[model samples]
Target: MKGINITSITLYSTVAFSSLFRSCAFQVVPTGCGGSRQPSTPSTSTGIGIGTGIEPAPTNSNTIHNNHVMSDDSFGSRRQLITSLVPSAIVTATGVSILLSPQLSFAEDVQVDPVIVDPVIVAPTGEIKKLFNEGRALEQQGNIQASQRIFAKVTKLAPRFIYGWAYLGNSQVALGSLDPAENSYTKAVNLCVESRKEEEKLGIPRCNDLYLLYLNRGSLRLNNGMAMAMAKEALLDLEAADSLRAKPDAVILQNLARAREVNGLYAASDRDYTVAISMTSNEVSPFWLRAALVKFQLGDTMGSFDLIRRVENRFSEAPEVRAALAAMLYAKGDQDIDTARKKFLEIPDRQRLKYRNDEFLLNTISWPPRMIDNIKALSDAVGDAGRVEI
Candidate 1:
């Protein structure tokens, strides 16, 4: 931002001061211009000489003389004139000083101090806090049934408490009570809406809690695979979660993208997947893999291949990356089979064991006979290497 020039700006004020004097009562007498001084008529009061020792004309005769005449009344008028001119003279001097000085500048360079407001501290009711803490402790300890009992009591005692309801919902989900969990999440969402105004005034952000509730419920609905209606409901919940979070989590975005894909929203799903991938810092992020899968499904084979190549370059030794790369190579047909076999054999048996039950990975890897034989040979080699080491 450019600053205003104080010196340039003061010039206008200097001009204004000059304008004030333009309508002055006094007129400037030109020096060395020969002219007779015109005489003025004298009033009944005593007269005072205003010029160079000029005698006052007598008022008794009705004669007009070529001499200037001014009355005592003019003294008061001159005093008023001086008083008015003094203020303007001072202002003009100040403006001129400012215009001429090098150090003086406008205060435009000074930055305004930011107002830092302290965060509002919200203290939950003692009984509710205690119950909530107990529930959390039990959940952390993996005692889901005990946690559910505590969270259930919390909801009964403080039905309006959003966190209580959220925790209760999570507990119910852990105990495989999907219906009760959905109901609890719904109740929490309603309370969050009702208390939104108070939350804003108190400088509290409860939207994240609402986001979690919706996301959990949506994920549960999707994973249940009961009906198409459930999938649509999951999409709605994920959308709500996306809107509430300040910066949407990559996991939530990936989930929403998958839900969109299931509902035949290929374009929207691709966009969400792209955003999710961009949000992630990890080169081998699951979102990247998921997006690659989406691209392949949409017949963007070249795009998918590029994404897989990126993962392979960054994590060449990772089993998941190698697995994905081999699958893509196999999709390209016989010309790439030798390269794919070499990549497939590089995946260690121990690494494959860790993801054996991963349904998504299992579905992703195109386990052809050659790939299976390669995996078996690699496992045998690993066993032989272990025996030789012993």
Candidate 2:
């Protein structure tokens, strides 16, 4: 991923439930994963990162122990969110995603380039290809159990075959075998890395995007039994591969940002959140910015000031924006109590009441944990900071 221009690659699955890949990204070939071809490199590495939603990246290969909690994943662990499945976020507040689920956001609909390895490497035997394709066919027909059986055999027979490993992981996921799926994906990623090292030795350039970024929304989800630290190492590695995407989705960026923030890579995370904020819908952007603001508040007060200044300029008097800023200011307590008071007063009573509604703030507003606490204090203020202030 070191400055190589990533050409386009289609998303597909030889596992199960990949109609989206057939429709949106590539036309699934009945014979193999044949589709529109882009000239990409030939190998990947074993870096794993946590990622959620869709697509993937080559992340670090830390063998995370199973006992660690979510925060234990490291500084801004890659927020690899497999949506509902992957345990996510550097902090669960503001919904920064983490970990690859079975259906993986990073590689949920992966369509591998047939020429995955350099010509020097021995490719899978014809018999293995036949079996792998057979598995793909069964998976396409929605017969996941049949596909899982075939793919498992394929991987066992051809352990070095990257596609075999990938397909095996995909099938395992469809069969609801998450731990086994992670193991399969891990092996595949290792092969990708090993292949890339060979390419480097041979002076060949390869783009291992398929393995590097295979965190599908389904596949990106963490097994509840796995340590959060191990998941974070994977997510961090996954985020490194995000560069290949043409129009990277906002959720991926935001989740990645949160992981970076947790890792204390403040500048990089700030940039990710800022860009993510721009790509998000107006209704949603403010809260994301609110999350960003708090993260900066904790790490860099100057950055928060810069961000709030931009928020005031761009959103102006938007209700959520005003409420967020007011909460932030009020959280500063005596430092900006007057400004917080004024900002709250500017809100229409109806809007103010909505912020007062804890349930609404929690469910709908998606407020960050720190800001949520601030909102509580602001709601319970008295005298100068109260509704009847001078």
Q: Report the Cα lDDT for residue 300, model 2.
A: 61
| Tens digits of per-residue lDDT for model 2, 1-390 | 221111112223333221221111011121111121111222222221111101222221111111000111111223233433545435457786566444345434444333333232223436865675577566656666787788789777766565555556555544556577667767656655555545243323232544233433112332222323344664554475455444664545554554454344556767777776666544333324544454644656566766666656766766666766787788667869788878877877655766666555543443446677777677666232244321
lDDT tens digits, residue span 117-218, model 1: 322111234666666666656655667778789878977876655556666665665455668877876876665454443324232332224454565566
Report the CA-based lDDT of candidate 2 relative to the real structure.
0.46
Which residue pairs in candidate 1 collide? Answer: 39-67
Error of 1 at 273 (Å): 1.6
| lDDT of all predictions | 0.47, 0.46
Strongest candidate by lDDT: 1
TM-score of 1: 0.48
Best candidate, TM-score-wise?
Answer: 1
